[model samples]
Target chain A: MAHLTYFNGRGRGEVIRMMLAAAKIPFTETFLTERQPFEKLIQDGLLPFKQVPLLKIDDMELVQTGAIVRYVAKKGGMYGADDKEATMIDMYYEASRDFYSKFLPVLFMKTEEQAVKDAKAAGEDKYFPALEKRLKETGSGYLLGTSLTMADVGFLEVLLLCVEFGGDDFLDDHSDVKQYYQRLVATPLMAEFLKSPFRKRKNDEQYIKEVKRVLNRE
Target chain B: MAHLTYFNGRGRGEVIRMMLAAAKIPFTETFLTERQPFEKLIQDGLLPFKQVPLLKIDDMELVQTGAIVRYVAKKGGMYGADDKEATMIDMYYEASRDFYSKFLPVLFMKTEEQAVKDAKAAGEDKYFPALEKRLKETGSGYLLGTSLTMADVGFLEVLLLCVEFGGDDFLDDHSDVKQYYQRLVATPLMAEFLKSPFRKRKNDEQYIKEVKRVLNRE
Candidate 1:
């Protein structure tokens, strides 16, 4: 069985959860809601880097988000058909992930300044258009190749959260991305997971407090 | 032919260069000394996300440092012998890389304050101790397995840089890591590469200025 330990929110852990859901893999979770328990886990040598989103599977405890994600993706056969294709998948995944990181702060803090908001919103066109260009260039109905891979999964995962942060019309400038996002969601696995109970909620003020409590920013 | 394009300094490009060198693979390089030429390359659509350390190999223009490193590791037969081993390699590599990132700002500007200096130095004990624990647990002389892999290579790479930044005695607290570092360096492949002209220089004031110019920090 796969078990996940993180906070009550979906910061770094959601993507791993989504990958599990999409693969129809059943997993349990433990939420570390306070600093003491988090410190205890670290003290117990459970976390490799004293960070969370730790997954215990195959009789091994895994930390590092990138490593856990790769293990899950490869296990689900979502890496790619071959090495060259896998390289492209990784490139797409990394690019999408880099773009996703810009919006991560939204989960913990609310920015009211228009300048900060504008600067954050500015990343959409700056990064997504290149993704738009790739979708148009590939014409394969996938990011790099025909079959669905972690690249597509990662891209769709980030796009959904970007929409959550940027609103329904977030992809207004990215027609191809919008279309691709829809196409990915309609896949049977994703369609099921989207409606499943494991789907985490978008952040709210209450949840932000919850996350802040876990972050324990003094 | 394997071709690399980056700025004159090592920065992000040196690891890929080392991996190639360790495998006795030869490659040519193109250096971009100015921002306009970089933007021009982006305009030409050679870069996936308008970044450097672009490697043209196997007829693919690869970007993303993590992805490029993965490809090179796999091709050089240094990834590991199997899936579980590769996962461990990924973990060690990502952890070491994360630790390396905290020191990257040293390349762009001078950090003179003792507090910042103290904080940077603090990371060595926080991180390398965990790595030392891993080394002791494995007892393979390598990081994860009995044979040398990217895990060892990446750890050594970061340790070398950390030593350059921190000093020769940086690993005095990490006897296992210190011993492992020496072991990796003494390997025939790494020993030769260490003496080769390809070994990049550490960041100096002039190199920092060069990097700042390429970064175009105004």
Candidate 2:
């Protein structure tokens, strides 16, 4: 059995959960919602880099969310269609990862509020459109190819986060992305996950407040 | 033929170059030493993310350094010994990539100098020790397994950069990492590359000065 350890929130662990679900793999989860428990886990040497979304399968342990996602994807047969497809998927994944990094400061902002917001706005203008372009270029109803790969799962998470922080119209300028977003959420397991009450429970008040404040430029 | 394009310096492209050399794969390179030429390539739609370290293999063009590194690692048979090994290699690669992300602001620091430098110092203190522990535990003379994989290649790059900025004594507290570093460089093609004058030219004057100043804590 695979065991995933992360915070209660869906911050970085959601993609892993979604991947496992898609593959029909059952796993246990241990959420670290407080500082003390998480610190204890770190002290216990459970985390490699002292970060969460750590996955343990039997005796094998792995860190890094991206790495874990790919590992699970490969195990579940959701990695990509082929080597070229895998490379393309990874390219978009890294690009989305870059977008996530920029979104983080604003999401957790305490200072230079306006500057950070403006930079995020500029980033959205750049990256989101590039993604939209790729969607059109591929025209495979997904990021890389026909089937839903790990890239789309990660990409959907990023898009949802962007919408949370950038407003509903975040991808309105790019019709393809908007449509792609709908198509992604409609994936069988993901769609079920979305409409489930568990989705609502996944929401953290503080997180919502931070995202709203950043979006509203408050 | 594989055509790799980036600036003349190492920045994100060196890892790709190292992987190619280690695999003994011959490829052509196009270096954009100036802003104008690089921008022209971006405008020409050569770069997907408008970023450097773009790899063009045949008709397929891929971006993102991490993705490119993995792609080359796969093609060169340096991906891993197997699926589990690949995941393990990726785990370490992502850890090293995270370390690289923290080291970046300090590398390109122009303001908030002391605060950034101090954070970088704290980061080094935390991550390097963890890496040292891994090296000791694995005891395989390499990061993941007995053979040299992409993880070692990427890890070596990060260590070299850390040493460049934090001085050679950066890894003094971590003898295992120190020994591992020597083992990496002593690889035939890598050693040859290091000895070649081309390595010296790969060093950008601005990069060295910036790194030196940060290490001096000025």
Candidate 3:
């Protein structure tokens, strides 16, 4: 048992959760709503940096989403067994993080136009090309090697987020990324997860719609 | 030979450079001095995400500071050999990244008052305690296992940035973090790194003074 503490939305927490699910790891998720508990957690110093997506493994806790994802990936055997492959997996994961750092801010915007403009300028112009090039270079289809690594899991979520929130057509201009996105969606576990109750929520639809809109615009 | 491409600063590029020095790996440091070249590289689609601190291995390019650090650490044998130990090493490196993310904005600020307020309210109040607790929990003195890992190297740079810019008294309240800083400074390689001509640049001191003045008010 692993426990993840975060808000209800996917955001940073989704990648680790999805990785765990794909790997068949059992974990409990504790979602905090409202400012009171968040403030209380801060005052009590329960959170390392007063941030969420903290992973609790038994008595020890790990903060930082990247670290948490890596920890979980290690447990799930998603990180390569060998050092060289592991390094490549780590590289891809970091690239995904860099991509998220740019696109995440745009998702929080209240209006669709602002999100589109930001995504087009940053997401389409910068992020997609880089990811497309990386995918093409790998030639293995997966972001890391033949099998899906945590990097693929992480990148898939971001691609989903872009289509789910930024708009579906966001990656239309970049064929490799689009193809990669389609391949990721075609995964049995991921496809099943998408069809679950988790994907039917209003917020989820809104995010997906926004992502679709962004894709269409492009 | 490894090649590092970044702006002429210690910023994100320092840890990689330091790791190479510690391991005695000979690598070319390609500093981009002008915006024109930086822009040109991005326009040519050379950069992954159009950012600096990219590591070139043979003909392949890698991005993300965290990913690059781990890759170099593995290559340099700075990361642990065992699975569990490597995970632990990664844990601390991730924590160091968390600390930097919290306090970096303060260092980048133009005014002294804002810098101090940001540090005290954000850095000291939030970041320091978290690091202090981790230091206390480690019990082995070093962040991970008995020997040094890239986590320590990365944290050393971050601590140096905080103290060199904010002042020794900046971490005065957090005894564990303070002791850790002292321990880092005691290392011969680190000490020599500190005294290098790179540390004496006028811009470095100016940035420190500016941030310190802001911290002083708080």
Candidate 4:
């Protein structure tokens, strides 16, 4: 049995949870609800790299969200079919991360309006178009092929997060991305997971409040 | 034959070059010397993510520095020895990337001094100690056991960059990390590559100039 630990947020842990659910793998999620215990875990040297989303299999504990997701994807057989597909999957995963890197910092910025504006612009102008083109070229099923892979799940998580930040119109110009996102959510396991209370438990209130404070000042 | 393309810089392409060299594999490094041609390549659809460090194997082109390094590492047989080692390698790779994430943005900030100070502090307080502990426990001479892997290569790149930013006395407190740095540089292929003109070809003039400007202001 795998024991996965993270904060009570969907920030980095959502994809891991989705991958486990998609693979029908059973794992216990230990959510750190506050900073005190998290600091204690760090002091105890239980948290490798002083971070969460650490995955423990028996005795081995692994850190780095990207590493954890890729490891889980490999174990779940959702990595990719071959070298080419894997390369594509890797490329897409990095693209999603690149997308997030643009906007995530904005939540803590003093110039939240300008930062949010830039993030939205980049998302609409660059990321969405690239995603739309890729999905169209590959067909509407998944990021790579007819079968689901980690890229699709990871990409969807990024899209959902950006959409939450950018609002519904985020995908209006890119129908393919919108449709592809719908396809991912409608997948049997994901459909069930999306409706679960787990999906609504995004503990990004601190970040959200900060962004709101900056925006209100603006 | 593999063809790697990037600026004259070791910014993101050095690891790929090092991996190929360490594995005794042959590859052609295509350095983009000018902005015009590089922009043209992006416009020509030559760059998938509109970024360089694109690895072209035969006809297929792959982008993203992380993806390229991992792929080249895989091809060069430097990924890892087993599944567990691979996970450890992955974890370390992401940790190295996380280290970069903290400092890289500092280069572009108005509060560059404070940012660099924080980055240097974290490098000393968090990253360096963790690395020293890992090195002592593994006793592998590398991050993994007995043989070199991508984690060492990637982590070395991060260390070199942070050391560059953190100044000469940065490693004074962490003798183990200092020794490890010397050890990696002494690896035959890495030693040769380090002394080569290739290592000095860092052509990120725009970024370097900007960082210098902000530091001068302080």
Q: iRMS for all predictions?
A: 1.3, 1.6, 2.5, 1.4
Candidate 1: stretches off by over 4 Å: A110-126, A204-217, B110-125, B205-216
Q: What is the Cα-based lDDT of residue A13 in candidate 4?
A: 74
Choose the strongest candidate by DockQ. Answer: 1
**Can you give the lDDT of residue B156 in candidate 2?**
77
lDDT of 2 at A154: 73
Q: lDDT of candidate 1?
A: 0.77
Report lDDT (Cα) of residue A51, candidate 1. Answer: 75
Clashes of each: 0, 0, 22, 0
Docking class of 3: acceptable
- What are the TM-scores, per candidate, against the unseen true structure? 0.90, 0.85, 0.82, 0.87
Candidate 1 chain B has its poorest 10 consecutive residues by lDDT at B112-121
Best-to-worst order by TM-score is: 1, 4, 2, 3
lDDT, residue A213, model 4: 43
Which CAPRI level is candidate 4?
medium
Of the candidates numbered 1 and 4, which has the greater TM-score value?
A: 1
Tens-digit lDDT track of model 3 for A1-218: 77887766677677777887777677787766555666676777677666776777746677677777777788778999776677777767777776666555555555667755665677666677777787788897787667778988878877876786657777888888889889888888778777764332334555544433422431
lDDT of each: 0.77, 0.73, 0.70, 0.73
Evaluate residue A102 in candidate 1 and report its C-alpha lDDT on the 0 to 100 scale.
Answer: 65
Across B44-70, the per-residue lDDT of candidate 2 in tens digits comes to 877767677788884878889888888
Tens digits of per-residue lDDT for model 2 on A59-162? 77888887888888888777786788888888887887777666565545534356456645755556766777777888888777678887787777777776
If both were scored by TM-score, which would come out higher, candidate 1 or candidate 2?
Answer: 1
Candidate with more favorable, higher lDDT: 2 or 4: 4
DockQ of each: 0.66, 0.60, 0.42, 0.60
For candidate 1, write residues A1-218 as lDDT tens digits: 89999876677888888888766668998887677888788889997677788999888888888888888888888888788988988888887787776665665455634433653454553567677788888898788767677788888887786666667887776788788888898989888878876677776676666566766763
